[model samples]
Target: MSEAGDATVDRAHALDAVLLGGPRTLTLRDLAERSGLDLEQVRLYWRTLGLPHPDADEVAFTCRDGEALERLARLLHEDHLGSRTMISLTRALGHTSDRLALWQVEALVEDMATRRDLDDPAARRAVLDELADLAPVLETQLLHAYRRHLAAIASRYSVEFAAGQDVGGDPAALPLARAVGFADMVSFTRRTAGLGSTDLSDFVQRFETAARDVVTQCGGRVVKTIGDAVLFVADDVRTGAKVALELARVLGGDLDVERERGAGGLAEGARGVTPVRVGVVWGRVLSRFGDVFGPSVNVAARLTDIADPSTVLTDPATARLLVDTPGLLLEPLPARELEGIGTLAPVRVRTA
Candidate 1:
């Protein structure tokens, strides 16, 4: 092997030891035997946690791996967690953390390149060198964020559902009744046409940061942010209205179409972030896979598509729910044929 290849391998092993807490010393079968789990069961757990199963005879497991397996076994026997639920939870963690790790690494790489004035390859090597030192701090922060989110969820459900207020829904419909919506950036493709990596990252990060702040401040939860849109949920129609209107207001502006078309599609808005048109609907939705689903979600996206920039649109049903809401006004727009739902009047929601 070349000297560089050997050096790379040494660095990788050193980093693995730091992150996993030891060298890989145990085979798959050893882990199962030591953790008191069946070989197939261990393989299933490993695969479910977003990893390919190691060969039974491959010495790929570390002490930490065996300990983690033991803890998982204890959850099954001592905590009595359902097998399916345990597997699903483990899968969720694996999936989320996988994306999260990649995102963090990319961010660190950008920082490294900018701060050290290195090229991309050098920046990546710098990140690898620094990551071992940063790992402990990052892990602590992750735990803190996890605990805070769990507490917030618990408190929210306890307060909202503890009174036994009926969350009425059709027997065959999607279960949860909540307000779900999308805030889609106008002229997204055109506006972001030729931005370089740094500029593009800044624009996207700014929009995401701003949108997330507005949603959380309005007592709403952000379901997810698509490439050029944000999906959010609120407990009730009124709160949803507030969230939608606030999002439109905060991210407001019509595309400077002439300037955009003329000047390489430079977006017009606060900090060059394009304006987002918002659509919100109050209806039942199925919650799964950390995302919301149902007809209402579709309707919301359709409304967003038809909405003018920096405006909030809603269906008639949702508009009616907000008629008695204070400090809000609803304006009916001309009837238009929504893609799936024939002709219908969409209402504009704005702060009064």
Candidate 2:
């Protein structure tokens, strides 16, 4: 390859390294070492681009540099931006807008409160103009942040639970009640890995949207989602059962659109769009850091493990609690053994 080609390759690799969690402020020396390019070669590209080279004393760089480097890396990776590129760019723009708005909001709030004595109407108008200018940008940022946060949450529930000696959380002592149970996605490992990040993002968003709608609609709160399963809590078992049923129905029915899109789409290919197994149980549990714990929580998880996709499974006790609620049918599952929890008979809530 020619000198230009080698230089391009070096920069490309450097950017990849940075994007994948390299130091924020990298010096030319560091780039030369990591990129296999001589210091002079790395310097040449910076000089050619008319960007400044901070002194070695100022070697630390910010995440902004890392982002810029990532952009450059992507440019070098492809002669033209493709679909993946567009998706990445869109996600990045959304993230950037969020960070910028957070910083801007702090500044605006500080200024608004501190400048009470600026009596000139023109100055006041300027402040109002600044706020007006920032309104849409800040609103977009908030919406994006909320959307991303929610997507991350729904994506957690699509998995099976495995107990390990791995790091565990410190238990808290507090006023406790038997909160609701939450079940995660059953085929999360296979499904999530097969989907691209953007698609994974979309899948998560759809799940959260549906889940939140049903939970709030039925007067329950979704405490949090953990790795493809959501943790929800209700004041009592009946409410929990109602919340669980609504979640399953919303998720199962919502797959229709993805089903029609095509066979290989996430909705269908993942064994049914929004088709998630649900488990509802009631027992004393502790809540902390947007998560619930205790034996009740574990049983709910295990029950979800036993649930078939598009179905809601509840412990026999939960079924008994809901026995009086009309139109909610329950059928016994064949005697089955579950990990962590022993031989059990769960009632599947049959849909009419």
Candidate 3:
């Protein structure tokens, strides 16, 4: 009997093998085979959670280490969270992790631990109950901290808005504070006017969808949508620039949907999609009511206007700050006479 029980233990250990390797980055096929899920089921989860399909070329999946797989599997299976909600929750939780505020981290860690299969039944229940009780308190504390930090930083930079008015604030600003920039669709004046309502809606939806994915992946926040454009803020310049460049690059490369709509799935005669231009500048700003503002904010808007339809442009200050950033290629542009700002030397950013 003891030998039989030992064999069962070995089986449990083998099942834990998935947790051994960090960020397996497995494909849909791999996930399906390992998790006993079908491809369609996995696809549903991805769609529900608004996750991009894993690319064969890119590091498709990852975790801190294989040990995380145990928790991840429980979250996926026992929690019964569909893929879409799971994805959104993952992003939210992941963002929270980036912050160093002790209470927030502790709260998250405590909540996460409740999902584990603990040996002590009484202790497990107490852990979960305590987390549930403390969650709201932790959330409130996090918000207060974020707001105070944002106010302090914005004050430090003496931020000013272009509209000569108050821009809204972001509730999640402190602890894991960041500078975020968003570049958006130009206007209703563009090609959108000629299309039907459904077509126009589809175009706008796709743009927003793609933009959000890029921002989340780059560890930035989308404060809110300003009609045609998105307002994004990142924790720092490198992250902000990467988000902008990625938005431009991904949007530029993905024209299949447009081609399908324009030419009824015919590739040869389909009109190409004109991707949105991106501009990013990083500096501390005032975040209020889910909005961001300041002088660095104004310069970012102006720089966006100067960018080509599918390129990212940044101010000299932002560029200089990123001189040491790895995997970034920065090129000096001819001293362009920027309106109101005068003879600006902006640097174009691309992946190195």
Candidate 4:
């Protein structure tokens, strides 16, 4: 191998050691034997972790892997966890970690390339070099974040449980009575058409960060961010309205000056801040696989599609709930024909 290739392999091994807490010493077969699990069982668990199963003879397993397998085996032996549940748990961890790792590495690469003026390959190399030092910190932070989120979920569930709310249901069943909303950037394609990669990334990141802040501060949670849009949810209509109105006010105001400038035939500003339109609905929704669904979600998305830039729109049901809300003004629009939902009145929401 070339000296560069050898150096890269050595660095990878070093990183593996740091992350796995030791060198890779066990073959797949050895790991199975050490953990008192059969090869097939090992493969099943490994594959569920979103990792490729190595050949039985391949010395790719570390002590950490063996320990994990042993713990899993113990749980199974004691009937503490069913095989299907274990598989599901591992799959969830694997899927989430895969995306989280990729996002962090890419963010690091972007920062390195932009701040250090390095090319992509050089930035990746820098990331690899820094991983040994950063891995432990990253791991700790991941655990901390996961624990906090888990605790919050537990607290929320506990409250409902104490209130005699029905918390038992099929894992894949849809949620009921959720406030679903969508906020989409107006003229996103046009605004970003001329931006370079770095500028575009910055713009999108800025929007997502700002939107998340607004949603969370308003007692709602962002479900996910699609390109040029964000989906959010709250337990009640009031919180959803607050989030939608706040996003429209803050994200839409950016375009106010631009609109005036454009009317006078002036050039756009360099900030690239795009205006957003929001739609919110209070209705039952199906929550599965970390995403929301159902008629409410669809209606919210469709409403967002037709809303004026920098404004919040809601169907009559949500509007009725928000009509008497303090500090909010709901201007009822005439019933209009929505493609799938037919004619329905949508209310424009603003801060009173």
Candidate 5:
């Protein structure tokens, strides 16, 4: 092997020791025997992590792997967890962590390349070199954040259950009452047309980061961000109204105070951020697989489609709920035909 190849292999071994809590000294068959699991069961568990399985004889499993499998087996035995539920839980962890790890690593690579003026391959090597030192810190932070978020979700559910707001039905059904909304950038394609990759990345990131700050400060949680839009949810209509109105004012440059602050040091090219139109509705929604659905979600999306830039359009139901909300002005728009939703009156919401 070439010297570079030898060096790469050495680095890989070092990483294996650090990350896997030991070298890859066990094959799949060995792991199965050690963990007291069948070969098919071992494969099933491995596949649930969204990872490709190695050959049965390949020495790719570590002691840590065996230990993890043993723990999982114990849980299954103790809790009598069904195969379906086990697979679902494993898949959720696998999917979420897979994307999250990729995003974090890529962000690190970008930071390395930008700060050190290294090329992509070099930056990747640098990241690998630093991973041994960085991995533990990152892992700790990840665990802490996950625990905090889980606690928050559980607390909210407990409160709702206590308040008699629980949706009684199939436990797996999606029938939570929520305030769902979408904010879409105006003329996104036109605004970003012909921009270079770097410029476009900055533009999108700036908008998303800023939008998230506003949403969080206004007591809303960002569900996800599409290419040119953000989906958000709040526990109630009032909080959702605050989120929608604040996003419009901040992103659309409607707030004189914010404008006076001069874009808060955003990139020069992105200083003139694109305006956004918002739509919100309060109704029962089906929360499934990290996303939301149902008629209310559909109505909010349709309202966003018809809304003008820098404005918030809300369904009449939500408007009625917020009729006496302080610091908000609601003007009822004429009944308009929306595809798949028939004619409905949407209220234009703004600062009082």
Candidate 6:
């Protein structure tokens, strides 16, 4: 083997030793036998964790791996969670951790590069040497964040879906009534056309931070971000309107708000980010796999497309729900045909 290949292998083993708490001392069969789980069960569990299944004869399992399998078994029997659910949970962990690991490493590389004025490869090499110390802190933070989020979810579900509070909600809905909305940047491509790496990163970060703050401040949940746009949800129409309007007003606001909130705005040394257009709809949506899906979501997206910059839009039905809402005005706009959604008479919403 080449000397470089040997060095790479050595580095990997060193990382594994630190993270796994010991050297690998067992194979697939050994783990299964030690955990008293069926061979196929262990294989499926490992595979579901976004890990490649090594050869059954390969000694690639460590004590920590074995302990993980044992814990899974205990969770299943003790909690009575079905195997399918456990597998799904395992997949979620694997999928999130895969991206999270790379994201953190890249962030570390950037920090090292910027601090030392080194090139990318040099900074990455330096980072690899320091990662053993950082891994434990990252692992602990991940666990802490996971537990906190899980508790928040439990609390939210208990209140929102209380025993018989609103399960059979509006529109013969999926569960509870929700306000789904989208706020997207205007002329996104033109605004971001020639931004350099650092400038673009700053531009995007500013928008995301502003958008998230807007949603949370107005009692809405940020579902996800799509580069130049944000998807959000609230428990009711009023809250949705508040989120959509605030998002448009905050992130994609007029020149005055932009100067107040984000001085540089859109791109550095470029024209500020133009006002955002928002679309909100009240309806039931399916929440699965960390995303929302339903006709309402689609309608909200369509509405945002047609909304005027720095304004909020919704369908007539959704607008009606907010008619009695205070400090808001809804105006009917000319109906337009949207693909898949057909003709929709949009209502423009503005703060009173």
- Quantify all predictions' global Cα lDDT against the true fold: 0.85, 0.63, 0.62, 0.83, 0.85, 0.82
TM-score of each: 0.90, 0.49, 0.46, 0.86, 0.88, 0.87
For this target, which candidate reaches the highest TM-score against the unseen true structure? 1
Write the candidate numbers in order of decreasing TM-score: 1, 5, 6, 4, 2, 3
Compared with the true structure, what per-residue lDDT tens digits does model 5 show for residues 1-352? 9886677678867986999898788888998888777999889888998999999999898889999888887777788888777777788888888988897888888888899999887888788888899899999999999999999899989988888886676686566889999999988888788887666866787788888888888989888999899999999899999999888877864233343555554333233466898999998887766788888888999998899998999988899999999999999999999999999999999898
lDDT of 1 at 285: 85
Q: What digit string (tens of lDDT, one per residue) describes model 4 on residues 1-352?
A: 9887788788887887888989888888987898788899899888988999889998897899899999998988877798888888888878888989998999999989989999987888788899888888999999999999999878977876677644257565454667899999998888788888887886787678778878888999999999899999998899999989888876754643554454221123322257789999998787666788899998999898789988999998888888788999999998888888888889998898
* C-alpha RMSD of candidate 6: 3.7
**Whole-model lDDT, model 5:** 0.85
For model 4, name the residue pairs that clash.
none
What does the lDDT read for residue 23 in candidate 1?
A: 86
Runs of candidate 1 exceeding 4 Å displacement:
1-5, 169-173, 254-272
Residue 15's lDDT within candidate 5 is 84
RMSD of each: 4.0, 17.7, 20.9, 4.9, 3.5, 3.7
Which of candidates 2 and 5 reaches a greater TM-score?
Answer: 5
Residues 1-352 of candidate 3 have per-residue lDDT tens digits of 6774566556444433433334346666665555566667555544444456664334455444223334555787898867566566555544453443453444344445445543343333444444445556866886897799688668645643322333236555432334556585544475566786446655665566666777878777687666578878876678898888877766663455565655332222222334667878866577543466776677777777888777888888888888889998898888887766677888888888
- Model 3, C-alpha of 21: deviation from truth (Å): 52
lDDT of 1 by residue, 1-352 (tens): 9786677678877998899998889999999998888998899889887887768999987999999999999999899989889888888888888889999999999999999999997788788788899999999999999999999988977877876534465468676778998999888888778989997886677678778878988999999998889999998899999999888877764334333533221122332356788999999888887899999999999998899988999999999999999998899999999998778799999888
Best first by lDDT, ranked:
1, 5, 4, 6, 2, 3
* Tens-digit lDDT track of model 6 for 11-52: 877987988889899999998888888899899998888999
User: Per-residue alpha-carbon lDDT of model 2 for 1-352, expressed as tens digits?
Assistant: 9775566566555654443356556666666555454566445445544446665436755555545555654564556656455445545564555556565655454456457544343333444446545566757877997798778545533321222321245454333555476756656677667776446755775566556667867767887766577878876677787888877765664344664665453324333345678888876676553467787778888888878886888878777877877778889888778798898888887655
Off by over 4 Å in 6: 1-9, 161-164, 169-172, 253-274
Candidate 5 residue runs with Cα over 4 Å from true position: 1-9, 168-174, 253-272
